[model samples]
Target: LTTMALVPQVRDAVDLPVVAAGGIADSRQLVAAFALGACGAQVGTCLLVSEECPIHENYKAAVLKAKDSGTVVTGRIGGTPVRILKNPMAKTYIAKEKEGADKLELEEFTLGALRRAVFEGDVKSGSLMAGQVAGMLHEVRPLRAILEELCGGCRGVLERMEKEGF
Candidate 1:
């Protein structure tokens, strides 16, 4: 389900405050979360490309290059899927997992891959963990500018929506 569908249901089901997450990369999404009854939103992929993010340059570049179909999920056989950018290693992992390979073998094959990406800039084999919103990111930006855009852009979107009677 989309965030628009899930956030309201969660808000109504819980007694405590509900914070929305997933695919919340920009002001339009942030505003939608509020409209859906979320007290706040949590964003990650958008920030991963930020200048302040500690991930390796190759990882950030992969995120910046991502398209709508850029990410894939692995670990489905184990009933625990994770989304990461498409690459040789991810493709191989998905193939092995689908073939019902040993879980420990797959785990060993990808172990330290995250460190390889973040520290060694190994985009070809490292795990470039990201979200569906990876497609929305286009550039490397400083944290301040990214935050300002996310917050400041809301006024314009809100104004447009109000004018259109949203």
Candidate 2:
């Protein structure tokens, strides 16, 4: 289910407070989660570009350049889905996976991929793992700035939504 659908359902299903996660980037998503019965929202992708984020500089560049459709999930065929920024390695891996390549062949693509991305800044073949929200990340800002904008904008967003009859 979409976050919009699942958040409310999960909240209704359990008595505990629900925190919406996945693809949460901006104020609209934050407030929408609360409206959908989520008490909070978790963010991951937006922080990947933060100044304090320890990812390689080249990897950060790729994320900053991402378009809305720049991410893809691999290992779906093996029941271990992972989302990463689309690179030559990711494209070829997905193609091979869909063509029913052997497990060992698939492992060849993944082994050491993340290490390459994180340590070597190898954007060509490394696994530049990021969420689908990578496209929304434009610049590298300090952690404090990112969070302040994210949290501080919620009231304005809520006001706008209310005006729009949400």
Task: List, in order, the clash count of every candidate structure.
Answer: 0, 0
For each candidate, the alpha-carbon lDDT, in order, equals 0.90, 0.90
- Please, what are the lDDT tens digits per residue for candidate 2 over residues 1-166? 5688899899989999899988788887788888899888988889989999998999999999999899988998977788899999999999999999988889976899999998899999999988878878889999999999889999999888789998
Cα RMSD for candidates in order: 1.4, 1.6
Residue 149 Cα positional deviation in candidate 2, in Å, after optimal superposition? 0.8
Write down the TM-score for model 2: 0.91
Error of 2 at 74 (Å): 1.2
Candidate 2, 129: how far from true, in Å?
1.3
lDDT, candidate 1, equals: 0.90
Candidate 2 RMSD computed on C-alpha atoms after optimal superposition onto the true structure: 1.6
Clashing pairs in 1: none
